[model samples]
Target: MVKTTGFRVLWPACSLALCLLMLTGCPGPGDRMRFDETAQVSQQGDNVCFNITDARDYQPANMGINPRSTPSKEKNFNFSPGLTVADGKLCIPPSFYHFPDKGQFIIEYLLISKEYDEPRSFVITLEINGGHIYNVTPTEREISLPYCRYVMDNSVGTCQL
Candidate 1:
């Protein structure tokens, strides 16, 4: 026969509470996440990483990492600004508007994405401190993604969780 003390009985409950706290500490459904990344034109060697503080088991999707060249230049031109390293450190230039010998190279864009429900809008807003820059309304999105989440073939949008 063994005598069990109160420590044994409370240990499980304390463990459970700790686990729950850890799990809920991060963003769950219907939370906004911010990504600090350098905006660039090309996908190759691009380092536009999107991440949230203390997050796992989730990812970003359908971000319009795409920007078209202004009509003035040839179809294939790298006018948009990209994050570059200067003095052995990451540097984001003052503007995304750039062209060879040309003043400000502007890219006119209207962003859109498939409605995601978990987010209620798949809401992703890109805010550039200097330069300027979604679709899927907050209301329409909340109801859409959850309905199509398990459909296998997602037409509205895509997300990994």
Candidate 2:
């Protein structure tokens, strides 16, 4: 007769779960996004637009934008080709949905236009006053440009430079 201990059964299951988690690279609370200080943000017509200036070396791929009131809720808008580059800047049309006095959005893209690489993502938290962008604030410490740049360029396993 074979006896299976509870520990033995749980160990295999736990190991498999951990392997799956690593392989998927699932983002958790600790996952932090890199900020783009070089991005030029503005209100164009009824929409908000973005472009990366000074850093001509980086191009975006698989670029998309999501406007939201909170992390889990995605707001809808009517726009074809959600993101576009005009005169060297990435831009998006205004959402038909009504926005609050302030708005928050996320832009995700692959830096250097590398389709296979993990996308660089950031949150743009803004406060609108008198129909203009009054403030662009960092949501957290890690998403600040200086800190993110250090991590991306100096992290032992992530960057060779």
Q: Give the TM-score of candidate 1.
A: 0.19
Clash pairs, model 1 backbone:
114-156, 117-145, 120-142
Candidate 1 residue 160 Cα shift, in angstroms, is 29
- lDDT score, candidate 1, position 62: 21
TM-score of each: 0.19, 0.44
lDDT of 1 by residue, 65-117 (tens): 22222233343333332333332232223244222321222222211224423
lDDT of 2 by residue, 1-161 (tens): 13568778888999999999999898876576644442446777777666554334345445444553445344332224345455766655554333455555544444454434443443444456657663244444414454332322111112123
Whose TM-score is greatest here? 2
In model 2, the runs with Cα more than 4 Å from the true position are 1-38, 54-69, 72-81, 95-119, 141-161
Model 1 spans > 4 angstroms off: 1-4, 23-161
Choose the strongest candidate by lDDT. Answer: 2
